[model samples]
Target: MSMAQWVETYGQGTVLAAGGVLIGLSFGFWAQRSRFCLRAAVIEFWHRRFGEKLSVWLLAFASAVIGVQLMVLMGWLDTGSARQISAKGSISGALIGGMLFGVGMVMTRGCASRLLVLSANGNLRALLSGLIFAVTAQAALGGALSPLRTHISSWWTVEGGAPRDLLAIAGVDHWAGLAMGGLWLAAALFFALRSPQRSVWMWLGGMGTGLSVAAAWGFSQWVAAESFDPVQIQGLTFSGPSAEWLMRVMHWPAPPIGFDFGLMPGVFVGSLIGALVGRDWKLEGFSDGYSMRRYIGGAILMGFGSMLAGGCAVGAGVTGGAIFALTAWLSLVGMWVGAGLTDRWLDGGAADKPTSLPAEGFKRP
Candidate 1:
């Protein structure tokens, strides 16, 4: 059956769910296998080692940018329809939220994607972190904290008008924008090769992650175009979808689940598969109450910050920025600065030492 006909018969939600599952599952598998962690990427850059890990992340972002632009060139996607693409941005929100999310990521020992992967590996601590992360995100987004969040986000919004990208700032056209995005991706590959010791597996994993994000855009666009009920054009993102999945679970008459909704569970399942294949599956937990306290605090901050900044590290920094949104870049800088400060604090004023990622970041035996 045709995509449009299939949507009519099985429901657009179903098609989207299926697409989300495939995308999320593949991404989760590669992420685990590659040990792709953005926090570690930043730390590597900070210490000036510029290792393979950071290169993987940059390559992923570049791949995503190239992929999305390819679809755009083909007229298969209109990236402007995505929520992350906007004429205005919350400058204060991006800075504050990015910093808070960064600190929270350090405390919880993982970003949104890493949390999903860890939970799949049977890390009970990650399970708790995921729960707190989801519930708090829901609260900040549409629950009790909505009023405060709305107030803060609206307090100092900046309106750039039309396009809302770096290309616009430079007064460039669509073709120039595409060229620039391509250059960014090429630059990422060049840097990846510069790393003294990057495994082929790491390179593949990073590229795979980018492909997932790019594929998500194509899938979303295809469905929206084919279906009578148009869906939002988007790529991979966890912060908002994490909350959406939670609400769907708690509600009796759940609202229609979007394509992105299926991604989290797919990631979980994919991570499980990766662990089983890699022989790294293991069950673990926190050492003490202090750690629990730290996790809760971190989750709360991450929830608030992600909502305010409009995304998490992967959501805002990689996926969104690759699509050419201006806020993504700002949020990324904020995350870098924030994570750096937290790393310094954890290092006990030994600011010169390289920051260490949490144990959860590793695929332990």
Candidate 2:
């Protein structure tokens, strides 16, 4: 093909990749600045009775809903681009997966994405979790459990032959869905605002979390629609991509790096750079072999759970929320419940404990 033709043919992947880079950078920066971790959110909420972290998470959800809804309304994206919303899947799997993921995150002291960023910051424990998460996720995606995932997903169906998203469940149009989602967002904001530490940074953190997912979705749609001469299209989420990258290195004939793959690496790299730039990079390890064991176990559960659930907090929680996917909501609730239970269990039935923020900070070299 001529140069012009080549540009026309290859431009989509390029644009999509660019968008992914933006999304990754934005999320890494925002997350680092805001200290937004779902495990931390739940822990702080229960222990300190502080809602800042929770509020940040809620804001992200609301922002994602609004951004994606607006994109759909503006014809920038088809709502179907969201996989968790449009794809057929088992609610039971999502719940089970989410619960497992939640418990694992608590045991590991971080979720999949959190582990990735933390590993980048030089947390050896997190590095171990990231490694296990990647392997288990791959196994679940196309390994021994793949059949189970497929079988269960195939058997489950929603009412009215509707899409598995929240809007469909409510029997509402896109606009109505957006409005309802916005209301939830508003409630999150209201609750956040009630916090004594209210500030612009907190609001931004919440909105950024949600917006990051919307951007990833839009970017995915753009890439998937684009025709690339030698490349494929993809979107965000940490679990599968991590494993895929490893597989690609070991086995040739792997698909070309796409938006999702690029974004995942970008988040890891971006966070590392951010930590270094902020002079926050440090190398750390587990306190003991027991801590190491718990971390690895947590990572394995998180990996398997994220695979079965169809995404991690960012993937299913924020991105799925943007599309109002019922499974996503279920997964989020399951994660929270699992996390709460894990925390309590860890504490030996002690219902009351002070919130434990990472004392060493999450920066790594």
Candidate with maximal lDDT: 1
User: CA lDDT, every prediction?
Assistant: 0.80, 0.72
Using all chains and alpha carbons, the TM-scores for the candidates as numbered come to 0.92, 0.87
| Residue range 10-125, candidate 2, lDDT tens digits | 67545555566778877776665556688877765666555676677777777888888887888878766455655567788788888999999888887777777777788888
Q: On residues 306-337, what C-alpha lDDT tens digit does candidate 1 reach at each position? A: 88888988888878877777777788888888
Model 1 / residue 282 / CA error / Å: 0.8
Off by over 4 Å in 2: 1-15, 46-48, 151-161, 198-200, 224-235, 348-365
Clashing pairs in 1: none
Residue-level lDDT for 1 in candidate 2: 59
- For residue 272, model 2's alpha carbon misses the true position, in angstroms, by 2.5
Best of the candidates, TM-score: 1
The TM-score that candidate 2 achieves is 0.87
